[model samples]
Target: MLSPEDVQKVATLARLKLSTEELQQVSRQLDGILDYVAVLNEVDVSNVEPMAHVADVANAFREDEVRASLPREESLSNAPKTDGKYFLVPQILETA
Candidate 1:
């Protein structure tokens, strides 16, 4: 069970300003959470393997392969600004 002082100390560390009523309410809530955790601690899981997730997970991406790409002219056709060979973006950095 968490005392009101314990909850107040945590609130102070977290920079939370709780009224006296709020402090008492939070203390009771935290104590209930701790009690639930204590109940969970009693469960036996010695044979269970630790895992990152419960479901079996696999890579969902398509296989990577070299493929044909759009021709340069077609790729550059939709650009708002472009030179003959490359896209022309506005200069953002000041040079030394």
Candidate 2:
């Protein structure tokens, strides 16, 4: 359970400017959320094993193989500008 003062401090840290009414509302809502978490903390889980994933899954993969690719000249021919083998574009920044 958080005090109203504690809620106000949190609001300040979060850069939120809440009116008195809104502060009260937010304090109550945060208290409710904390109570729910407290309830969850009381659950028994002694027999449960921790796991990263819930499903029983196996790795599915495909073999890597080389495939034919278009010739460099043909590929760059459609570009608006190119530097022989690669596409060219304007510089993003000026050197100092």
Report lDDT (CA) for all predictions: 0.89, 0.89
Q: Which residue pairs overlap in candidate 2's backbone? A: none
Weakest 10 consecutive residues of candidate 1 by summed lDDT: 54-63
TM-score of each: 0.44, 0.43
In candidate 2 the C-alpha lDDT for residue 4 amounts to 84
Residue lDDT tens for model 1, 38-96: 88787899998878776776767976999899999999999999986899998889899
lDDT of 2 at 84: 88
Candidate 2 lDDT, tens digit per residue, 1-96?
788899889999999999999999999999888888888678898998978786778786878888889999899989999988779999989999
> Which portions of model 1 miss their true places by more than 4 Å?
44-96
Residue 33 displacement in candidate 1 (angstroms): 1.4
